[model samples]
Target: MKKARLWSLLEDGRVQCLVCERRCLIRPGAKGACGNYVNVGGELFHLGYGRLSALESRPIELKPLFHYWPNSTALTFSSYDCNFHCPWCQNYHLSFRMPDISQPVFSPEKLVELAVREGDEGLSASFNEPAVNFDFLVDVAEHASKRGLYFMLVTNGYFTEKALDALLRAGIDGWSISIKGCKGMQKPLGNIDFYVPFRNAKTIKERGGYVEIVYLVVTNTNDYEDCYRWIIEKHVTLLGVDTPLHINRYFPAYAWRKPPTPISKLLEIAEEAKKSGLRYVYIGNLHNPRYETTYCPKCGRPVIVRNNYRVVDWKLEKRDNEWKCKYCGYPVPIKGEYIPEKKWLGLM
Candidate 1:
């Protein structure tokens, strides 16, 4: 544990955690709303700092970031703790309940070294709220940036302005913000404002970082037609219609045991999203072979085809720093090139 950042002390013996939008005022020897911050003798201590809970290599597509670095691998790592307590959380074992197994501390330099050694083009913090490990993320990202590796985050996107600024200032290259439509949902302790995720995504983009939005359509909860339409409109107005939007399927997990999302529902929305003018739309967390592929918005040709997270086909060419479809003159919004198929065959 380290001395936490983005927090301040109180005169009456309480400390406020500014790590998230909740602004949780933690009392002595008590944890914050996120269950990660603690007040230890009038000082705010981050219980999750530098505690490496999981680490692995994955394609950027798995982050659901289809536009930036399509097939490149990123060395992703995350510690314990989250800003939200979603009952439908898939990684409850990692995010909700901190693992009882031993979690070792990894220094910023050590993490950067590992990423360089592993031959990753970038690094990502995922599996939980990356902001909970703010100090570590900033330091490690700064070091990694100097070593020619970029940084990305898969976050719930409910950060305070200070937290968001710290990340953008540290050179976060890309983001995937998950929007859970649980606005005004009651927790045992505090309530949540669901719109904060959109605000966080906007902040990242306004600060000039590439961003994509993911919405898990849960049946009988946030899967209404109007809700999807409103989000699509907002994405067009705020983030741009061309922004990559991932419509992921929800499955039963944790406390909420609803039926798995229907593939028919995914297709229905995919058609709606296309008609809604979203250039890059993907259906994730479930296999819908048709929707998983990226096509040219103008010519209607399949530009990138994938099986699972693996890219099986890429038909893009870079000219004068812009991506163009090889078949037609249509421009692709993707940022990086598809590495040789062989280079992407293995993480090494």
Candidate 2:
């Protein structure tokens, strides 16, 4: 166990964790709602540090970040434990159980070396919650940025402002915040309820970082049109019309056994979001390639064509170090260098 860096002592020897939005206050020898942070002897420590539960090289598309670094592979790493225990969590095993810390330790330097050796375009902190392992992520992301490698975060966006501030300063390139439900849905796992999507979205955009919102449309739970409209009004409206919104179809996973979200419902919600002035919206977990590709909102031309997880064609014209469509003059929402290399193409 490692002493957590983002915590403080409270009155009467209690300890307060400032990692996620929960702001869990714990008494001596008690664990917070996350189950990984414990107040031992008046000091809070992160129990999951250095406990790597999962690591692999995956296509950037699996992260579902089509716009940021399309057609590239990323070295993804994750540790066990998450601040929120969503019933529909896909990776509940790692998120809820304590990770086997006996796995070989890889320092920030070693991780960067692996990413370069594998010809990876970037690094992703995913599979489980990365914010719970903030210490390692911050250090590794800083090193990756210096080497001109992209850094991505697939997070729940429950992080505190302080945690977000540290990551923004560390040069994270992209972040995808999952929006499960509004404030009125059934209580979140662990009985902890609090997620302000609008506030979090605003903060991420203000930092000049790439931000995407993922809303899991669970059947009969949060698939209402009103909730979809609320998300667009609160999160996407202020961020401009170009922000990417992913409407993922939810299936029975982890502890929940609900039926999969219907394709009709997904399309209905996507249509509603577009009418709300959202430029880019995509449907996930289905076999429709048309809904996955990105088009130029200005001219309605297909700028980036995607075949499942692979990017088939890119119609971007580079001038003055910016990407613009060749057909029209509309700007495409992509980042990083588009080097011409066959190795990166095969991994897409």
Candidate 3:
């Protein structure tokens, strides 16, 4: 166990955890909303640190971030417990549980070295809400950067600005934040504003870090057409027109199992988002080669061709230290620090 960096001592032996939006005022000898942070004798402890529930190499495409370093592998890992209890959580087994004895403990440097041994040039905090063990991610990301590996986060975009500031200071190269539009939905995170994620995404882009967004379209939940338009408008006006936003289809899983999002709806939302002057809108989760490929937003020429998860071909040219489409010289917003040489599916 380690002391959390984002906590404060309160009166009468209560420690306030300011990591995610929950901001739990944990009482002494009790865990917070995530069930991982504990107020031990008037001080908060991050019990989830180094206690990994899942670890593996994940495709950047699987993160649905086609614009930022396509086909790059994120040597990713996550810890137990989460800040939010989303009923449709896909990784509830890890996120909604405590650290078991069967789980192995790994230091920050060890994880970076593990990625190096596997020839993976990217490291990510994912599979669970990374806000819980953010300091650990910072240590690993800072160490990984020294070894020429980029760092990123696949997060639920429910963290506070204080945590975001720490992550950027600790060498986070990019982020893939999933934004939920329905603020008043069942069990919505407390004290979180709907516009906070858009604010955070804009800040990341302005600070020279890559930001890709995902909106998981769930049936009869947060899958409204206006949600897509709002996200598109924010992406186009605030982030950039070329900002990559993925409209992902949500499957029935975890607690809220209604039905999978229709593929036609994803296609329709993608089209509407694109028609709103936003480039690089993609339909995710449901497989279709036609929707997976990246085309030049200005010229409409295929720049990166993807089949399922593998990159079939790339038509980007690096000239004067910028990646641009060869067809129209339109700059593609892809920020490729390092591309994985081996197939991640084939064990890179």
Candidate 4:
């Protein structure tokens, strides 16, 4: 029940929600496209503030963030409501449906306390669209950053420039923006424009924040080689060769009943990305053990070997708080405190 933080009033009695690219204009007593922000009597109010739907300590790899923290765990949280209505959404039950907001409210301080108690490396706003619950995320992130805990946003990267800037200012350590597909699909959710990754990646990189791109390759929708190449050329050429890319295998979920993306297609896309001179490309959702590991681009050696979401072995050496492969002295892109001596649970 917080007043929406990032919106403006229009002259025609409509309020514009500057949360995402939608910039939804809502009249009095009407909700935005996200379903979380409402124009209540000429004022904008956020509906999902302090309302959490799920919380857990999960492996960092489960966020599929291999380049950020290879083998650590993060305290993850998700609230109800999302800005985009992606038909293939896997978390529709929670994101699309309104939760019982009166169940219980956890303040930002309490959420930070829980994250610290769990001994997690960071906090991940995932499962649902964190942007829809922007107020809660900013509050929690501010507290977590003050306590030296990292903050991550597993978002669709469709946030408005102002909202995105505010999150970066609040000390967001990492961002994994899902690039759904190239432009011009049947629905709003399926389209991914060249401007999004190209623009957002530059912004994230300039802020000294880690940015990774996740591409969910549906069979006939966005499985084209040209789209993949465009992403590589745009991001890699503009950002850097070391920028991380996660090619996720899309399964039939929610309203999408298509077959799962084939392993061969995933491999081919990875190969295409590699040939485009991108260094770190990964395949997700499939059980190909070798594809899950991170290899040193310099010497072609497995620097961080993974078994699903678990780190089987780490052959990196730390020097001045940065990780580099001892074999060839090549810098590793991962960012986290390395606990080589601590034993950890294997991936489930």
The TM-score values for the models, in the order shown, are: 0.93, 0.93, 0.94, 0.94
Clashes of each: 0, 0, 0, 0
Ranking by TM-score: 4, 3, 2, 1
Better of 1 and 3 by lDDT: 1
What is candidate 2's CA lDDT for residue 9? 95
What digit string (tens of lDDT, one per residue) describes model 2 on residues 228-332?
777767665566778888899998989889899989999899988898888889998886779889888888988887775777778888877778888988788
Mind giving the per-residue lDDT tens digits that candidate 3 earns over 110-180?
A: 99999899767688888888877776887887898789888888887777789888888788977898887
- What lDDT score belongs to each candidate, Candidate 1 first? 0.81, 0.80, 0.79, 0.81
Between prediction 1 and prediction 2, which has the larger lDDT?
1
Question: Candidate 3: what lDDT?
Answer: 0.79
Residue-wise C-alpha lDDT for candidate 4, range 1-348, written one tens digit per residue = 789888889998899999888889999988887788889888999877788888988877777788786666778898887877677899999878874657687798998989899777789999998888888888888999999988898888888788889888888878888887664554445433546755776888888888888889887777877766666677677778798888999999888888899889888989988987888888888867688877899999998887757777888888767788989988888766654433345322
**Candidate 4 Cα deviation (angstroms), residue 336:** 2.6
RMSD of each: 2.4, 2.3, 2.0, 2.0
Per-residue lDDT of 300 in model 2? 91
lDDT of 1 by residue, 1-348 (tens): 778878898998999999888899988999886677889999998787788878888788888788787778889998876778778888777788552325667889998898899888889998877867888898988998899888999988888889888888888869998877644334421366767777777777787788999989886777777767777777777787778889999999988888988878877877788898889899998775677898998899998887767778889888878888989968888765566573445443
Best by TM-score: 4
Query: Candidate 4: deviation at residue 100, Å?
Result: 3.6
